[model samples]
Target: MNARIAPPATVALQPDAIIRHARAVIATEAEAIGALEPRIGTDFVEACRLILNCHGRVVVTGMGKSGHVARKIAATLASTGTPSFYVHPGEASHGDLGMIMPQDIVLALSYSGETDEVLFILPTLKREGIPLIAITGKPGSSLARQADVHLDGSISCEACPLGLAPTTSTTAALVLGDALAIALLEARGFTSDDFARSHPAGSLGRRLLLRISDVMHTGDDVPRVAPDVGLTTALVEMTRKHLGMTAVVDADDRLLGVFTDGDLRRALDDVGVDLRGATVTELMTRGPKTIGPDKLAAEAAQLMEKHQIHALLVVDADQRVVGALNIHDLLRARVV
Candidate 1:
């Protein structure tokens, strides 16, 4: 016969109690993370030096909750210029141990510093001459004693009500991992451009790596008209290009001014102006704001926002009209 499962017990809900408990957890974790500031001394420095000097990737390993934190730390290090990856402790004991090399450094995380799976691979790691960095709550544990550099991740107590679940201890380990990644990032002089390269598909990559030339309308797509053209001709060019404006260039295609919808509005408002006889030069705004095609698309967005204009003409260093772009182009590229 199949066994029958018992129903879960019903309890009364209390909003005040729930909020109070959440606030207490936050306070405890904050205190635990704050306490770690003083503990970052010689051992932290040594860990950074070991990873920086190592020719191979930093292999992070842990069990249970520490394993989750280790994965995050490895990702942060990899994205921030330090090459690193996470390996499961239990998996490492099996054939997965072959993934680690002698030149690589091993970073182990365990709250008790005596996890059996993590310890099981220590003998192999030592035999292969791989350097070890250990982070644990217990300073005198076997893992800490055996590590070339041990970072003390001790916490007064966990934020869990039962004090059994990994809470404050996990937070401490995560923060320590971040501290190490950032220190090495600074020591290596990593820049935002370098970070963007690792995240090419992200919005940050689009902003940093995207150039104006990559998004601008070039050649015949860019609306251009001679300065001597009538206002009606410029309007037709603007309508055909759909950029809300047309560049007024000389015979050599060098920018002289820009004729925009705003200028047309002002021309219409002036009863003294003759619409039929007016030339593009008479209505054009002289010395309009422009950008080089080599400039970043982000910079073009900044310029447009600062000037309260919707469009820009891309030019060469010698003032030759090369391309054109508007806020809509940036929006389509998701750079705005």
Candidate 2:
């Protein structure tokens, strides 16, 4: 017969006590992080200098909770122009140590500075002449002593009520990791465009890298008509293109003005105006706001917002209408 396991007992939920404890945890973690600011001194500068001069990747390794923080640090470093990757210390003993090269730098994290798995790989790294940077709460521990540069991530206590879990300590280590990544990013003169390249699938990438030419309606897709075209004909082009606006161009395709739905509305409001006999130039806004095809789509969005207009004509150096885009196009491209 199969044995039945008894369900665990449940404690009564206490809203007031729960909220108080949560706030205490936040205060503890925040204090621990705040303490780290003044500690950023010579050691932190040396760490950044080593990483900036590293010819190979920053191989981050740790055990347990420290390993989790190590992974995040590696990712942050990789995305912020610092080439880095996380290596499991335990796996390093099982031939994964081959992943570490002589030219690379090893960044090890351990709160106690005595994590066996991380310590187990220290000799190998040393034998290969690879530099080590250690972050540990215990300054005198073996890991810290062996490191070429040691970063102290010490905290007075963990935020955990039982004081056994990695709480405030991990927060300190993570924040330290972030500081390192950002400092290196600034040192390298990494720009938003550089960051966007590393994150091409994200919204930030689209905003920074996407150009007006990449999303604009080009060639025949652009709704363009002669300045002499009647308002009715211009309306037909606008409706067909579904851009809510049409560009009025001369015989040489030079943009002269733009006729939008707002213009059409005002024309209808004018009792003296005759839509049947009105030419596009008569109703169009002359010298409409324009953007270059090579400009960022985000810049175009900014221009539209600043001018309180919904559409813009993409012009060339010679003022020729090469493309067009409206607010809807920006939305479709997810650039707005």
Residue pair clashes in candidate 2: none
Off by over 4 Å in 2: 1-5
What shift in Å separates residue 324 of candidate 1 from its native position after superposition? Answer: 0.7
Each candidate structure's TM-score, on Cα atoms with residue i matched to residue i, is 0.97, 0.96
Best by lDDT: 1
Cα RMSD to the true fold for all candidates: 1.5, 1.4
**Model 1, range 225-294, lDDT digits (tens) per residue?**
9988998899999999999999999999999999999999999999999999999999999999999999
Clashing pairs in 1: none
The global Cα lDDT (0 to 1) of model 1 is 0.96
Candidate 1: residue 183 Cα off by (Å):
0.5
What CA RMSD would candidate 1 show? 1.5
